[model samples]
Target: MSTRITGTSHLKSENVNVWFGERHVLKDVNITFPANQVTALIGPSGCGKSTFLRTLNRMHELIPGAGFAGKILLDGTDIYDPQMDPVNVRLNIGMVFQKPNPFPTMSIKDNVLSGLRLSGRKTDDASGLLESSLRRASIWNEVKDRLGDAALSLSGGQQQRLCIARALAMNPEVLLMDEPCSALDPGSTRRIEETIVELSESMTIVIVTHNMQQAQRVADETAFFLAEDGNPGGVVEFGNTEDVFNRPVDGRTNDYVNGHFG
Candidate 1:
C-alpha cells in the first residue's frame, strides 16, 4: 500500500522571489499545495511559473546567483532552513520535465529501482515495488512484459510514464511536472494526462502548463500567472478549476484562455 500522507501542507511558498544575477524572475508569490490534490500553474512564456516550480524543490540553487527570498515549507517544516538538506526535500518532492528523460542506459526495471538504491534502501520487494509503481503510473498493463527493456526504448508516452513510475518508486509526497505534454503527440498527451489524474488521488501534484484545455481536464485547481514590468511574474488569479475556467474574476484570464493576448 502507498504510505498514508499526514495531510500536512505539502508545499508552501511565503513571499518567495527568485533572481539570476541582475534579473528577478519570480515575484513575491505565496501558494500552498495540498495533499492529494492537483494544482495547475498556467501562464505565458517567461512568466515565472517554471521558476516558481523550480524554487519549490530548491532547484534554483543550481544556477549561479539564483538566490531566493522567503520560506518554502514542506509538511509545515521550513525547507529553506540551513539545517535541512536539499536532497531530503528533493527526496520527498520529485519532478518530471517537458521532455521524456529516462536514463538512457538503465532498463525499465532498473530505472524504477534507481532511486531506492540511491537512497541506500535495502531488503525491499523490488518486484512488488516495480508492480506498484508501474500501476500507479498507469503503465503496468502496457509494460509488464517488457520490464527488462531499456527505458529509452519505450515510446515517448511510455517513457514519460516510466519517468513518473521512477519518481513514484522513490515514494515522494509531491510530484512536479513542467509542461509534460509539450513534447508529445495528442494521443500520448491524453494517456499521460489520464495517468496524472489517477496519480493525484494519492499524491500532491503541481503542473506548469501552457495548455488551458489540458489544465481544465486534470487539475483540481488552477492558478493564473501574469508577467508585468518585464522583471518578475505574479499570480493574477487563482481558484477552483471550474470557477477559474468558467467565471474567471480577471478579464486577462478569460482573454488568454480564449486565444487573445497572452
Candidate 2:
C-alpha cells in the first residue's frame, strides 16, 4: 500500500525498472510520494539515484538507447501510457538538474517565463507569474531589482534559484530535483533547503541528494538505494526520515546511514 494525502496519492512508481541499452541499472523499484510533502532519495554514487529521478518525469528516455519498464503514476494516471504526450508529462512534472542551468543570454525575468513561452502557453499576467515564481523560490527580494540583467550575472546559488523559478512558472504538480544543492556553498545550500521545505506546503517534491544531513533536514520521508557486488541498484529501505536514519529495518540501510559503508 502507498501513502495517501487527502484521500489520493500524489505521485508513485510501481515496479519501475530502467536500462541504458542492455545494462540494467535499476530494478523493480516501488515508492510513493505523499501530496504536499518532501521525499528524499539518498545513496552513494553509481547507485541509480539520478536515473530514478529522471524516470519520474519521463526524462530518462532522452538518452538515445535508454529504455524503461513499469509505471510512473501521477494522480493515478500512468505517465508512460502510449497515448500520453511526453512534453505534457514534463510540463506537469518539472525537473531541476544537478547544476544550475539558466540560459546565459536570457535576462533573469525572461528565464522565468521561458518555460511558459516555449510551451506556447499564454498567461494573462506574465509579470505576476514571474514575481510569484521568484517569491516562491525565495529569490524575489534578491533579484527583483535586476530583472532585466543577464541570468549569468547572478551567483551560482542565485542561478539555481532562478532555474527553480523557471520551473515554478509552469505551476507543476510535482517537482523533481537531482542533487540540487551539491554544487553550492554552505550558505546557498541552506537557502535552497529552506525553499524546498516551503515549497512542499503547496506541491509534492522528490529530491536526490547524497547529503545525509540535508535529507534529514528537509525530507518528510527518505528512500535509500544501493547496488552491491556488481548488481543493479534497488531500494534497500524506505520510511519516515527519522526512522530511515535512526531505526532502519534493513541492516544495510543502517550501515549506509551510519557511515559504516555506502
Candidate 3:
C-alpha cells in the first residue's frame, strides 16, 4: 500500500524506485519538498542523485529502458497517473540541467520564450515575461540590451542563468535543478546560489549537488543519497539542513558532511 504523506508538501516521492534496463538505480527513495523551500540532494557520483532528480516530473522515462515504480505527488496528485499528460507535468515542473543548455541558434529573448512557443502556450505579454524571467534568474541587467544576441554568446555563468530564465518563463510551480553551478567559476556559483535562495520564496525547488557547502548554504532541508557495495541508491538520512550537516543521525551522513568520505 502507498503511504500517505502528511503536512504541507509541494512535491513528494513515495516508495519511489528507478531502473535502467536490468540495473536498479534508485531504491525506495521518499522525500517531501516543502512549498517555497529549497531541498538539496547530496551524494557521490553514480549514487543515483541525478536519476532520482529526473524521476520527479517523469523525466526519467525519457531514457530508453528507464522505468520507475511508486508515486511522485505534486500537491497530493500523482503526476504519473495514466490520465495525466507528461507534457503538462513538465510544464508545471520545470527543470534546469547541470550544464548551461541554452539554444545555440536562438537569441536571448527567443531562448527564454522557446518553451512557451514550442508548447503552443501563447503569452499576451511576451516582452514582460522575457524581462521578468531574466530578472528572476539574475541576468536581466547583464543581457537586457543584448536580448537579440545569440544565447551562446554569453559567458558560461550567463548561459546558465539564461537557461534558468527559460525555465522560469513557463511559470512552473516547482523547479528541479541538477548541479546548476558545477560548471561555473566560484563567482558564478555564488551568484547562482543566491538566485536559488531568492527563487525559493516563490516556488518549490529540488536540487542535486555534490558540493556540501552549496547544500548548506541554500537548502532548507537536505537528503543524503548513498549506494554502497553494489546496492541501489537510497536516502541514508534527511532532515533540516543544520541537522543534516552538523548533527546527522547516520554515521555515513556525518562522514559525508565532514568531508571524511563521499
Instruction: Compose the digit string of candidate 3's lDDT tens values, residues 139-187.
Output: 9999999999999999999999999999999888899999999999999
Tell me the spans in candidate 2 whose CA falls farther than 4 Å from its real position: 1-9
lDDT of 3 at 112: 99
Please report, in order, the local distance difference test score of every candidate based on alpha carbons: 0.87, 0.92, 0.92
Q: Whole-model lDDT for model 3 versus the true structure?
A: 0.92
Please give each candidate's TM-score.
0.94, 0.96, 0.96
Better candidate by lDDT, 1 or 2? 2
Instruction: For candidate 1, write residues 107-194 as lDDT tens digits.
Output: 9999888887777676458899999999988899989999999888899988998988999998888899999999999998999899
All predictions: root-mean-square deviation over Cα?
2.6, 3.8, 3.9
| CA lDDT, candidate 1, residue 161 | 86
> Where does candidate 1 stray beyond 4 Å?
1-9
Residue clash pairs of candidate 3: none
TM-score (C-alpha) between model 1 and the true structure: 0.94
Model 2 root mean square deviation, Cα atoms: 3.8
Error of 2 at 128 (Å): 0.4
